[model samples]
Structures are given as structure tokens and as C-alpha cells.
Target: MADGMLGYGTTVRIGRGATPTWTPLALLGDIEMPDEQADEVDVTHMQSPGRRKQFIAGLLDSGELSIPMNYIPGSASDTLCKAIKTSGEQVLVEITLPVPSGETAVPEVFSGFLKGYARTAPINDKMAATATFRLSEAVEP
Candidate 1:
């Protein structure tokens, strides 16, 4: 991963016959983020399709996803923190994937995976905003 990406880890818990199962997963490595001034963070970079899918898969595989957003400690607030303090803030990201035929149900899988991941994942000061899925496209395979 690039220095611009953030590092994260996750744990998932599943319920079985009135019992819950727990699983954990961590980022393969640290991710890089776009350089910005102190207190000016950009959460948009974290919304890539590959990242999203990997997150979802992590959740499905372990029943939990943990994303560690990169942070710079300083006197100023970053774009990410600014957006977090303000409600109704939105960012756009584009993702491309090799279109899968048949009944892959990417969206459904993504939703379920996120829900499961979010249920157990923790958000801290390092996190600027929540992860959201935007678009998916099939590339020539």
C-alpha cells in the first residue's frame, strides 16, 4: 500500500443458535493518504471500490471489518475532522471492478458485510467519516 492509505483492523461476531462467534481481521498493511495541512484531513480517499470490496470481504470472512484512518496530531483541524463535526457532509469516490456474470449480488453482499462489520467495529478520533459504497463498474476481462 501507498503512504497515502490508512491502516485498519476489524473483528466480527456471529450468532449461532443463541450463541455468538467472534472473528478478527487487520489491514494487510498501512495505507497512504493525500497530503494535507495539519487539521485538514480527506476522508474521500478511503472510499475506493477496491477498499470497499476488500472491507466487505474481510467482514464476510471474519464477520467484522476494522478500518484505521490515518491521523496527524496537531493544533489545527483537518478536512476529515471538519466534516465529522458537521452533519450531512458527503464525498464522492469512484470504483471499478471486473463485472461478474450470473447472480453475484455484489450490492447485497456489500450491504450485509458492512452491516456486520459496523456492528462490532469501533470508530475512534482517527476516523474522519463513515465508509460508504458509491459505484461499481465492470472492466473488460
Candidate 2:
């Protein structure tokens, strides 16, 4: 048995505004959480003895979250993704992780706009789709 929680029961929900009515996305395959990054700011000056680069952290970015799914045309997930992209509106995405045997599920929430929704079809493989959410604010882990 593995010590970590399994990804099988994880689920993602999305909706509009600061407070929203979350709609569960369906047929999702796997979800990749956002990778946060911070910008490095250089603070080197002429008075520095060894000319070592002095640095500081600038703005923090709650990188993009990508969701891959089995593409189902006209499904709620498909329709919502398209609508969100077309509207260019900020939405709240809540990703709930699977709970361990004795622990509770925690949802990571963030606000972002749907960057892209791409669909693919192959003759020898199952149809698939992916949605990229570009985070605009700090993620609540």
C-alpha cells in the first residue's frame, strides 16, 4: 500500500465571480496542480566588493493548472470550458484532493481565467481534451 493519497478520487470544480456556484467537471483524466514561482530581482550595486549578484524576490506567480480529460462533445465540462474561454472572465477553480484514511480532503482554490481549451482526436487513440487555467492570484493551498 502507498503512503500518499491516491489521485483517483480527486475532483475539480469551477465557477464565476468572487463567490460562485461550482459546477463539477466530468470525464476528467488527471489534474496537474499549479506550480508557484517567484521572480528574482537583482539588487547589485557598484559598492559591492566581489561583484556578487545581490538578489531579492519580486512578484509571486501561481502558475498554470492543466486538466486533461476524455473529450465528450456537448458535455457540461466541454460547454463550460468553451463558455469561460469565450467570455474571458475570471473564475474560481477548486481542486479537492483525495483524503487519506484518517485525514480530511482539502481543496486548493484559486482565481484565474481559462487560457485555452484544446481538443484532439486520433484514429488509434481515444479522443482527448485539455484545459489550461492561468492563475491570476495566490492559490489557497
Candidate 3:
């Protein structure tokens, strides 16, 4: 397997609202890729012989996209904080990442809604907010 370009894993950005024009959503720390699960069923038994069996094609459960960033008092990312702080309904947002070894401009879009948001003020560090978005649906037609 070929190793990827240096710093490629750090490529991440987000956009807000329907038909969001992309933006360079900054990050203050590591970005966690959405966690996935491969559920399995036990199917070893009687007729033949004792054997272990399970399916790797388990349903891919929905995931949470948590973004933690330094809070700029008036930065674009602030929208994320506002999203969770107060809301009338689900707010649509878009998370983008480059296709591995491919063009950075054309990203893979994981569009969904903001599940929740929270802010933190560490005594000795810059104010920050962790935006947790639940990826519930695909936007591509």
C-alpha cells in the first residue's frame, strides 16, 4: 500500500445551510473520523462441525462528527456554537474532506444536521467549542 501525502489526514472543513458554499473551517486540534461498526452474528453449529462464523457486512450505523476548535469571538466557526446553544429545529451543515490521493478542492461531502454543541473555557487556554454533528442523511441526489 502506498503511503499518503504528508498532512493529508488533517484536511477537513465544514459548510453550513442548504447549498452551502464551502469554507476553510479551521481546527485547533486533531479531527476524529466518524466511527463505524461491523455488527456480527454467531452462526456455528450442529450438522457439520464446530466452526466460528460471522458476517463482516454489518450495517454501518450512523456516526457523530465532533469538531473541536479554538473559539474566535467572531469567526465563521462560531456558527457551530450558536447552532447548539439555541435552536428551533435541525440545522443543516456540511463536512468536507479530500478524497485520499485526490484533488483537495473537490471534497467528499458528509452533509447532515447539528446534533448538539458545547463550549469550554480552559483556565489556561483559549476558549473553545466542540460541535458534535450527527450524520443522519446523505445530501447527494
Candidate 4:
């Protein structure tokens, strides 16, 4: 049996869609898919004898994409910090997962605005940065 690929083989890339493609940026240790779900509205019928009902959906709320990476000057974290500071701007994110069949698979895609960035200063470990993005618009790839 073949062993599965390790997490280290996964890659996270980001770009602004300026050069006709996504440009890989930053060395992220971990990346996550968006946590998104459908929205609903309550429409209980008064004649239904105290039964509550919810409509299927209205709009999907904004999802989040989280990334953790080593904090370095002029690195991915730095570039993300700059992006996050911008007002009302969204960026693109792609996560590539390696296949165990000895080939590269198509990378998953997402797009969202840079929402928040947190920096950690650890005394005994490598410093890191965590970024959160508010995702929207059928951004799955």
C-alpha cells in the first residue's frame, strides 16, 4: 500500500489577479478551508399550532479562511499584514494538496477580504502570524 502524503506537502498561495494568474506568496504552516453555511429565515405559520419552521436559505454568510505562518520581514506574513490594512479589499487564496497517486491534484480555491491578522511573540518557539479572511462569492475551486 502507498502511504498518504504528509501535510508538509500542502501549499497555500495568494494573489490579486493582476498578472492574469495567482502568484504564490508566503510560507504557511497551516491553512484552512472556509467555514461557511447557508442562511435561513423563520416563517412559522400561526395556524400550525406553535410549530416553528425555517426557510431553506437566503444568503450564505461570510466564511473564514485562516492561515498560520512564520513571522518574517518581507515574508508572507508581512505581505498579508499590508493587505489586511487596506480598506474593503479582497484577495485570492489557493491551497494545493498532494495526491498519493504520484501526481499533483488540482488546488482548491477561495477569495475573500483580509479581515484580521494576529502576531505572536513566543519566547521559546518561532514567532508566527495568524490571519483571518472573510470569504464570499462561490470561491470554491
Candidate 5:
């Protein structure tokens, strides 16, 4: 296998409107990239010969992205996340993958709706939250 880039410098940004003005979120942890999947259709037939199951591809799912970050109430990131969830509006997400030296960066841009935002406060640990976004369309270059 070839050498792959590390996840040290990965960044996630969120924005709104037709011509979105991107702003990076002060993420505190790893970012889960979109996991694109396709649905399968099973077609079974009973013939004179042995029975077999046929399958075909159905609709494609762009998949969801889960991001973990520090929870700072009333902050811009927190407010934006809540607004998106409350309004049920689609927002733009830009994920820039880190590349090696002198290599062009790869960005995965897509439109998605904020699915969920949950915060946790532990006595021994810091306050953290997870934001989940459901992709509504194909990810662009």
C-alpha cells in the first residue's frame, strides 16, 4: 500500500447561502467524513432449476457526517449549529483533506442538513458535543 496522509491537519467548515462565505469551526476532535452508500434490491425467482437470488442497485445515499467539538454555548459555532437544526435548513459543508508537501489540497464540498446536535458534560471531563449532518446531494470537488 502507498503512503497515505495523516489526519493531523484536517479542517471542517460550515456556511450558508448560495455563495457561502466559509468559516472554519474550532473542532476539538476527529472529523468523520461522509460514508457514501448505495441501496440494494433483491430480486428472487423460482424457476425449474435451482433457486437463486438476483440483486440490483437502487438509490444512492450520500451518507452522514459526524463531527466532535468542544461545546461553547452562545458561541458562533454553537449558535449556527442550533439555528440550522431548528430551521431545518440545508447548509454547506467543506472538508479539506491535508496533503503532503507541495501537493494540492483536496476539498469535499456538499450540501447537507443538520440532523442532530447533542452535548455532554462530565464531571471529570470537558464539555463536548457531536454534530451530525445528513448529506442531501453528491459531494463536489
Candidate 6:
């Protein structure tokens, strides 16, 4: 399912950290990036904190879920700058997952597994920089 079409009840797990592991719990269709207008703001600079907070707030507000920042990995500094340069006024967040062939419940299982992974996984500086979201339900379009 496409990220844009994900449902409100759908759960999402965003992969973050140095090891590319899942950490944050996110609702699939609930994620959003609200439009912001900042005069004289540099896209590169605005993309980091501004975009990150927008993403977090939108998802949390829509899904009514809370995710700890310590669990995610990946620095917003470089990534934000890169995203701004590439997308102009917008930032791109790419999500990839293994889609199960037969069972449609794979995404939900993945979400639960990710939550468990976050609970037991060790935190390191490298692993502390990424962002992850585990959604409430599997998205279906």
C-alpha cells in the first residue's frame, strides 16, 4: 500500500538508527506533514526541525499514539539538508517493507515485532539517530 493511502487505523513501523532497524510506532494513514510558511527561512534549515516536528505531531495527533525519540536512529542534520536540496520545498521520506505474498496480516505482525525489537534492542549513538514508527494497523488501499 502506498503511504498516502494508508488508513487511519493502520500501524506503521519506520526504520531508523545506524543499523536500519525499526523503532518508532506510527499509524500508517495518520502520518501527515502540515503546510508551514516561514518567511526568509532556508529550506535546508527548515527541513530538519520544522519538518521533523510536523511529521511527529501530525502522526501522533491523527493516531493518538506516542513514540519515544530515543528508540529511533539517524541524524536529521544531513538528511534534512539532502531532502531539501532534492525536493525543493518538500522533503521525501521513503518507507520500505517486506510484503507477504499469501498472508495479508504480515504488516501487523511486523508492527508487533518492531515494538518488541525496540523494547529489547540496545541503544547506541549510531542507533540513536534514526526515526521509526510502528503503526496501529496494517494499511490497506
Tens digits of per-residue lDDT for model 1, 1-141: 334422222121111122222222222123222222223233435666566433211111212222333333331223323332344322222112223335342211111122211112236534232222221221121
As for candidate 5, its clashing pairs are: none
Candidate 6 lDDT tens digits, 56-122 = 1222211212223333333443243233334333112233443444745433222211211222245
Candidate 5's displacement at residue 54, Å, is 0.6
List candidate 1 segments past 4 Å from native: 1-67, 74-77, 95-141
> How displaced is residue 22 in candidate 5, in Å?
1.6
On TM-score, the leading prediction is: 2
Model 1, C-alpha of 24: deviation from truth (Å): 28
lDDT of 3 by residue, 1-141 (tens): 776543344555555455654555566456676765555655545553545453346666557778777777667778645743466344444444445555554444565566676777788988987778777644452
Model 2 TM-score? 0.92
Q: What does each candidate score in C-alpha RMSD?
A: 21.2, 1.7, 4.3, 2.9, 2.2, 16.4
Best-to-worst ranking by lDDT: 2, 5, 4, 3, 6, 1
> Which of the two, 3 or 4, has more lDDT?
4
Candidate 6 deviant stretches above 4 angstroms: 1-6, 24-31, 34-38, 41-141
Model-by-model lDDT, in order?
A: 0.25, 0.88, 0.60, 0.70, 0.84, 0.32
Rate residue 10 of model 5 by lDDT. 86
How does model 2 fare in lDDT? 0.88
Which of 1 and 3 is the better model by TM-score? 3
Lowest summed-lDDT stretch of 10 residues in model 2?
1-10
Where model 2 places Cα greater than 4 Å from the true spot, the runs are 139-141
Q: Per-residue lDDT for 11-128 in model 2, tens only? A: 9999776668889888888787888899999889998669788889999999899999899899999999999999999999999988867988879888999999999998999999
Top lDDT prediction, candidate number: 2
* TM-score preference between candidates 2 and 3, better one: 2
TM-score of each: 0.20, 0.92, 0.63, 0.78, 0.89, 0.20
- Candidate 5 has its poorest 10 consecutive residues by lDDT at 43-52
